[model samples]
Target: MAEGVGRGEILLRPLPCRAPPPDGAPVTGTLRLLLGDQLTRSITALDGLDPANDVVVMAEVQAEASYVRHHKQKIAFLFSAMRHFAAALEAEGVRVDYVRHDAPGNPGSLDGVVAAAVARHGPAHLVMTEPGEWRVRQMMEEWRETLPVPVHIRPDTRFVASHDDFADWARGRRQFRMEFFYREMRRKTGLLMADDAPAGGQWNFDAENRKRLPEGERLPDRRRFPPDAVTREVIALVERSFPDHFGTLEGFGWGVTREDALAALDDFIAYGLPRFGDYQDAMKAGADFLFHGLISPYLNAGLLTPLEVCRRAEAAWAEGHAPLNAVEGFIRQIIGWREFVRGLYWHEMPDYAATNHFDAHRPLPAFYWTGETDMACLAAVVDVTRRTAYAHHIQRLMVTGNFALLAGIAPREIEEWYLAVYADAYEWVELPNVHGM
Candidate 1:
């Protein structure tokens, strides 16, 4: 059993076969299938869960972790977070059918484990939030046909904009631009909007956000969460299972739980957000994290919601805790670029992955994986990526991605590299960003 996992939570031992209640005593339980990314407690799938009969099924399968040679820390962070989330659910008396990757008879794939859980629980229905990737969405559709019970794939409500909203905004437009979509989201969410106009009398502050860091400027200290026992176990598991994966786990400091994520958010808003805009695009040697909010992984993984993050930043600006430029830029990232890419991904996926406008077919350079290059910019970004599995947008777009594009590296190869290396690299976000690049 995983550390802190309560009794009856681990599904290793065979559960007693639940006999049909006499004359339909209430209804059978709803089986909730929570993917690794759907760790939020209030996710739509769990909205009306009844602890008495409902069972939440979560699995740390090998397939997802090994799909693209994910960063070791990435794997560890997810597993640790999932485990923590399961434990928290169990503490609330929610029955969690948790499966560890190394558990005996582990099927090693999401569909397999979910099927096993269904067979064991004999649920009346299976519920899950919509997946983030096109391939996973296809798998969910397959589950609808294959599973014995009804499968409900609810829309993920954590995002600011829905798929329909994006589609409506994109309809009949020859060119899809994020600026307009962002303005719509601002109006829709009423974020940074005053009555009918945008805050600061403008919709964008990119012009004011490009100042280079002044010489010898003191950077704020970032909050780091040293590995606790749960995370340490996950680290050990990842190190033992994935010795050949990219990136190191030596200095793994990411917060895995919701509390930790909130603390990191507060830390960023208090210290980093004030100076975030000025040097968000600046890169300096020996400064891997310069005033940038290191909360993308948390946000992407559902520990933080997009609207809540944007609202907090907006509040910071309103309360004079951070400047308008910094707050607006940060909010734009969450509500604007993040939502826009997600919209683009779902809108054009299954075919979007095949669209390579450049038609470049050169192989990705060896140094993208090894960081063994002489070019200062490329080497620095790759080095940071290898050590931390993180690089700000500018580092991704301007440095590594630019090098790949200029060198005519195959889009698929570079796209796979981005997905494999970054902790926050999911297909919906990474693919669109790579395509845009």
Candidate 2:
């Protein structure tokens, strides 16, 4: 374990730190807030600010971890990401009031944290990026109605399609299919179509993307970003605080900064995109990554946007750097299924979580947590998930989700695992994919 930090301790293992603002410069206003999957950049709150008078507040709340028995890497990922982001804000000359999970006198829940921050800081107003989960949104609504200061919730701009846009698309529809919505998005965005026609002759190359690897086939080594000091600190904290949780820190390699995330994206574009379309859905023994883009963490954290990623993939296609199938397949992931799932979540949620359409009731097998299953495919996928807190879409849907479906594991139980393990999981994107798709 890394030295010094522990659960809930406000240990500032600086990624890149800023010298404190000129000593004794009179403190003025502060804004209490929350940052989970949607709320990333400080600009979501900072852009409307009088920085000379406003300080931005963010916290690593214990309620998040305790709400579900989260996978260890998932807990480590969020806490580390938040710490890195907080450091970035401080570097930009923004005053940040950060509450660490293990800090003394810290509140375990967002409600308590925000209330305490407001009581002490007394800002003129509270601003936040609207949360993606119904429960969090409800809490925020309650706080807005009752809190001392006026709370301002801003719409997230990370996605290409808005909540209203998705609702409008679903109007008068009886059955919702992602392909139809994706075609509309393609036309609206001019992604892979030329004059409203698919760039080649096909709208989807999924037929070509599903071929599995032949036995004993060697996969090119998956690229990984080395953990920075901040991530190391967070890993130490997880080791000390969550010894019983699933997952290990031995091979903890994740990007902690925006620059590292960008690098990871470029690496995928160069090394993986050519084969991404061909094996995008393939599963095999010991092969965890099959040419999948690993930028979900950055995208989920607001470090990157769907538009920017799509634009880059499109640009790669335009330049002949990658083939149409590969580029289109990757683009579809972001603009296609990603948006569709979010819409389905918002459309059916609160109820969606309870819709055990198949009514699966068996407990999730013990090996899901231990990755000790006898099935080769499942063991490989779960092992990778336990170590990295990540698995590409196919691994998630077909392998793990398929096993859960076969074993009759409760949808709620399976949903909890998906939500708890992946860095990209937010209720809006995670729920519909797990429960319905």
Candidate 3:
């Protein structure tokens, strides 16, 4: 564990510090753009990049921060994580050009920043992994034509399937259920696969994983991290700048670095994973995170990869620390529902954004904003979301999302609500869950 720092006792094992990259070195290679979500070193944008010659650009732009009414805690977590990632890259002798959102005379857009970087460094080309949203991809297309250097948009290789691979898988299928897709992913990753068969003789344990919380059952101790110096600075900024946002910044304990994320994963494996499936669908009045690994924020932010998380769960099963039902269910979520939703979003987007098969056209009820409904379940989950910017999948789907769909709420309105409220809300994942499934 690292030092116990900031508001509360958060024992975070900090990544080893290295000397920062010096300036005025001759720039001879590509200038790669790293989005806030794309913080990993293994991303294709930095492939074959020379730390001495190449430059990496990361920014906190106002346009993205204010694109929607994001929870104040959500903004603080992402901004702090991005800052830490840039510092980590710079310490590894790579030149990082980090632009702050409040920088003097800074342009409020990513393309504008890229244009300035090109003028300053004069790189051979610009490289980036494919962006998470269709909107950003369109922006990149315009940049390719106008920028001084050739722009390369590489495939984001973090997933088991590429866009082309998913397109191929989806071509002739009339009905796109997640089970068939998940089986293929299982085969591809060889996760829980025992040669020609699945481990423990089943492909899915979903039926076995749906037990509710019994009368007085217990949940293991949840690991919480206190905001470090970088995080504290971000929290202060968010509190000052966006005080009226949807959520509070009081319990801001997400792990912003890879080491902290791994520690969270370890905590889940030891405490949460064993009982995860048993209570995967459980929802008591006051219980917020019951046996669920609340690591989606880190997973979405690129600090923790989906594959790695799934692998850890499978390892727990193999070592007999957790049962097969729990491990399989957890793995299925990462390789199954998560990947399927992303593929569906990308495959059907631009048009997918317009999906309203049910023709539900009611405005979101006032209770969604204030959690003031007479319904105890609805009010409880919304209160949790308001305070922590988190609710388990069941609360999101069954309680909140179900209410929206049943009342015939406008799809876009609810879409933005899910996007703005959750810590793990991103278009690639959130849209399909809201509009399609």
Clashes of each: 0, 6, 2
lDDT, candidate 1, equals: 0.86
Candidate 1: stretches off by over 4 Å: 1-9, 12-28
Summarize candidate 3's per-residue lDDT along 1-437 as a digit string, tens digits. Answer: 00001110111122222233356543246778888888788988888778867778777776777778888878888888888887888789977777776666457677777787677667777888888888888888899889867788998888878888799999999999899999999999999999979999999998888786788897687898899999998898778777778888998888889899999999999999999988898787778898999899888888899899999998999999999999999998999999999888889989999979999899988788799999899899889998888888999999989988888999999998888888888889888998765
**Clash count in backbone of candidate 1:** 0
**How far is 32's C-alpha from truth in model 2 (Å)?**
5.3
Residues 11-92 of candidate 2: C-alpha lDDT, one tens digit per residue:
3222222223355553235473647453356436555555556666677777777577677776777777777776776777
Full ranking by TM-score? 1, 3, 2
Candidate models: Cα lDDT each: 0.86, 0.74, 0.82
Please give the TM-score that candidate 3 achieves against the real structure.
0.92
Per-model TM-score versus the true fold: 0.95, 0.90, 0.92
Best by lDDT: 1
| Clash number for candidate 2 | 6
